[model samples]
Target: MSVKSIVAIVVSLIILVAGVSSVYVVDEREQAIVVKFGEPKRTVTTPGLHFKIPVMEQVIFLEKRILSLDVPPQEVLASDQRRILVDSFARYRIADPLKRYQAARTEVGAARLLEDAMESTVRQVLAKEPMNEIVSGQRAELMKKISDLTNQRALTFGLEVVDVRLKRVDLPRENSEAIFRRMETERQREAAEKRASGQRDAVKIRAAADRQVAEILAEAERQSQTIRGEADGQAVKIFADAYGRDEDFFEFYRTMQAYRKSLGKDDTRLVLSPDSEFFKLFMDNK
Candidate 1:
C-alpha cells in the first residue's frame, strides 16, 4: 500500500473510534451525567444526541421514570409495648442526578439508604404511638408522616419522595389470636345482653296487651250483665201487669211451664190427684 493511503486509513480508524466514544443518545425517560475522571462535570436533561471529550469524559444515564421501592415487613414496638408487623412501599423520582450520583452511586444504594431512613422514621414514629394507632385507623396519618420525613432525609440525595404507603399493619400471630378471642367474647356478651333486654321488653309488652284485653272483656261482660238485668226487670214488670189483669190464666200458664221444665225423659213415675191444681193442665180436656 502507498504511505499516503496508509496514513489516511489510520486517521479514519481513529476518527471512527473517537466518534463512537463521543456521541451518546439520551432517551426521553433518562438523564445523563457527564463525569470526567470520576468527577461530575455536567448534567444533560434534554433528550437528544450529546457530545463530550472522546477519551476523558464518561456519560452515566439515570432513569427519570417514577420508581417504587417496597420495604420488607418490619417489626416495631409501640409505646404500649405491643409488637406489630408493618409492610410498606414508597414512590420516588430522581430530581438531581449530580447529587444522586455523589450520594448513591447505584440505584441499589439509593434504595438501601431509603430503606434505612424509612426504618428509622417508622421506629421513631411508632415508639410514641399506642398499639391501636399503629395497627389500625391511623395508617394514613402515619404514612403521611413517613413520606414527609423520608422526603426531608432524601433531599440531600436529590431524591423526591412522592408517596409512602403502608400495605398492612398487623399484630403478631399470637397477639392477633388473643385480640380475636377478646373481640368474639365482647360481641357474644353484647348479643346476650341485647337478647335478654329484648325478652324483658317482650314480656312487658305482652303484659300490657293482656291487661288491656282483660279490661276490654270485663267491661263488655259488665255491660252485657246490665243490659240483661234491665231486660229481666222489664219482663217482670210486664208479667206483673198481665197477672193483675187476669190472675187465674197467668197462674195456670205458670203451673204448666213449671211441670214441663221439672219432668225429664228418664222419669219412671209421676203422681198427682185428679182434682189437684198441678194436674189441672193434664185433666183439662178430660
Candidate 2:
C-alpha cells in the first residue's frame, strides 16, 4: 500500500474514534455535569445529544426526576416523654448539580445525608410536641416542621426537601398491652352493667305479667259467679211456676226427684219397713 493511503486510513480511524467519544446523549429523566479531575465545571439540565471534549472532560449524570429517601425507622421521645417508633420518608430532586457534586459527590451520598438530616430533624421537632399531636392531633403540622428543618440542613447537600411524612406512629409494646388490658376491663364492666339492667327489666316484666294474670283470673271468676247466680235464679223461678200451676203434680214431681236422689247410687241401701215414708208413695200408688 502507498504511504499516503496508509496515512489517510489512520486519520479516518482517529476521527471516527474522536467523534464517537466526544458525543454523549442526555436522557430526559437525567441531568449531566461536565467534570475535570473530579471537579464540576457546569451543569446541563436539558436533554438530548450533547458534545464534550474528548479525553479531556467527563460527564456525570444525575437524576432530574424526583427521588425518594426512606428514612430508617427510629424510636423518638415526644415532648410529653412518650416514646414512639417513627417511619418516615422524603421526596427530593437535585436543584444544582454542581452543588450536589461538590457536597455529596454522588446520589447515594446525597441520600445518606438527607436521610440523616430527616431522622435528626424528626427527633428534634417531634420531641417538642406531645404524643397525641405527634400521632394524630397535629401530625401534618409536626411533619411540616421536620421537613422545613431538614430542608435547611439539606441545603448543604444541594437537595430540596419536597415532602416529608410519617408512615406509621405507634405506641411501644408495653403501652399497647396495658391499653388493651384496660380496654378489656372496661368492656367487661359494661357487660356486667348491661346484664344487671337486663335482669332488672326482666323482673319488672315478670311482675307485670303475674299481676295481669291474677287480675284476669279474678275477672273471669267474677263473670262466672254472676252467670251462675242468674242461672240459679231462673231455675228457681221455673220450679216455682210449675208448683203454682198444679199442686198434686208438683208434689208427685218432688217425690220422684227425692226417690231418684236416694236410689240413684248403685250401693244405696235403707233399713226400713215397707210402710216407711219413702215407700208410702209406692203404697199409695199400689
Candidate 3:
C-alpha cells in the first residue's frame, strides 16, 4: 500500500471511532446527562439516539425507573423512652438529572445520599411517637410523614421519594422477654379474677336453687297435710251419718269388728263372763 492510501485509511478509522463515540443511545428505562469539561451540558430524559461532541462531551446514564434502597437496621429511641430496632426501606426516582448529577455523580452515590436523607427523616419523625403508635394502624400515617419529609429534603438532590416503609420494628431481645413476662403475669391475674368471679356466681346460683327447692318441697308437704286432714274430717262425717241412720246395726257391726280384731288368732284368749256383751255374738252364733 502507498503512504497516501495508508493515511486515508487512518483518517477513516478515526472518523468511525469519533462518530461511534459521539452517538449514544438512551433506552426507555434510562435518563442521561451530558457533561462537557466536568460541567453539565444538558440532560436528556427522552429515549432516543443523541449526538454530542465526541471528545469534549461525555454521557452519564441514570435510572429512569423507580429504584429501591433497603436501609440497614438502626437502633432508635422512641418517644416513650424505649429503644427499638427499625428496619426500613424506600423507593425513589431521579426527577431532575442535572441536579442529581451535580449532587451525586453516580447511581451509587445517589443511593447513599438518599439513604442518609431517609434515615434522618425516619429518626426525626419517629422520635415524636411511641413504639405502640409506630406498630399500630397509625403506622401508615407515620410512614407517610417520613416519606413526605424525605421527599422535601431530597428535592435539592433531584430525587423524588416515592414511598418509605418500615419492614420491622422490634424491641430488643432483653426488653421483649421482660414484656412477655409482664404480659404473662397480667394474663394469669386476669384469669384468676375471672375464675374467682365465676365461682362466686356458681355459689350464689346454687344457694338460690337450694332455697327454691326447699320452699317448693315445704309448700308441697303443707298441701299434702291439709288434704290429709280434710280427708280425715270427711271420713268422720261419713261414719257419723251412717251411725245416725242405723244405730243398732252400727253398734252390732262395731261390736263384731272389735271381737274379730281381739280374737282373730288361736293364741289369743280373753277372761270374760260367758254372758258378757262381748261374747253375746259368739254365743248367738253358736
Candidate 4:
C-alpha cells in the first residue's frame, strides 16, 4: 500500500468517529438536556436523533415518566408524645430537566435528595398530628398534609410530586408490649371482682337454704309431738271406760296380761302355793 492511501484511510476513520459522537438518540421514555462547557444550552423532550457539538457539548438524559420511591421506615414522635414507626412512599416526575441536572446529576442522586425531603416533611407533618390520627382512619387526612408539604419541598429539586402515602404506621415494640400488659392486668382484676361477687352470692344462698331447713324441721317436730300427746290421751280414756263397764272382767284381764308378761321368756321362775289367793282365778277356771 502507498503512504498517501494509509493517511487518507486514517482521516476517514477519524471523521466517522467524530460524526458518530456528534449525533445521539433520545428515547421516548426520557428527556434530555445539552450542556456546553458545563452550562445548560437547551432542554429536549422529543424522542429522535439529536445533534450536539462533538467535543464541547454533552447530553444528559432524564426520566420523563412518573417514578416511585419507597422510603425506609422512620421513627417519629407524634403530638401525643408517642413514638411510632412509619413506612412510606412517593410518586414523582422530573418536571424540569435542567433544574434536575443542576440539583443532582443522576437519577440515583436525585432519588436520595427526594428521600431526604420526604423524611423531613413526614417528620414535620406527623409530629403535629396525634398518634391516633396517624394510625387510625384519619390517616388519609394526615397523608394529604404530608403530600402537600412534600410537594413544596420537591419544587426546589425541579421535581413534581404526584402523591405521598403512608404504607404502615404502628407503635414501637416496647410501647405495644406495655399496652398489652396493662390490658391484661385490667382484665385480671375485673375477673377477680366477678368471682368474689359470685362467691358472696353463693354464701348468702346457702345461709338462706339452711335457715329454711331448720324452720321446717322445727315445725314438723312440734306437730308430731302434739299428735302423739292427743293419741296417748285418747288411749287412756278408752282404758278407763272399759274398766268401769266390767270391774271383775277388767281385773281378770289384767291378771292374765301380768302372767303372760312374767312367763313370756324361757328363763321365767316363780314360787307360790297352788291353792293360794293369787291362784284363785286359775283354781275356779279348772
C-alpha RMSD by candidate, in order: 4.0, 4.1, 3.5, 4.0
Q: Which 10 residues in a row give candidate 2 its minimum summed lDDT?
A: 277-286
Task: For residues 1-286, write the lDDT of model 4, one tens digit per residue.
Answer: 9999999999999999899999999999999999999899999999999998899999988899999999999999999899999999999999988888899988899999999999999999989988888888588788888898888888888998999989999987898999999999999999999999999999999999999999999999999999999999998898789999998998898888888898899999889889877677778674
lDDT for position 55 in model 3: 95
Which of the two candidates, 2 or 3, achieves a greater lDDT against the reference?
3
lDDT of each: 0.90, 0.90, 0.92, 0.92
User: Compared with the true structure, what per-residue lDDT tens digits does model 2 show for residues 1-286?
Assistant: 9999999999999999999999999999999999977777888989999998898889999998999999888999999988898889999889878888888877788898888889889889988889888888988788889889998998876788899989999988887899899999999999999999999999999999999999999999999999999999999999999999998899889999998998999999988898887776778573
Clash pairs, candidate 3, are none
lDDT of 1 at 140: 82
- C-alpha-based local distance difference test score of model 3: 0.92
Against the hidden reference, what TM-scores do the models get? 0.74, 0.75, 0.80, 0.77
lDDT value, candidate 2, whole model? 0.90
lDDT (Cα, tens digit) per residue for candidate 1, span 1-286: 9999999999999999999999999999999899999999999999999899998999999999989999999999999999998888899999889999999999999889888888888888888899887776587888888899989998789888999988888888898899999999999999999999999999999999999999999999999999999999999999999999999999987887787776745664668677886776666574
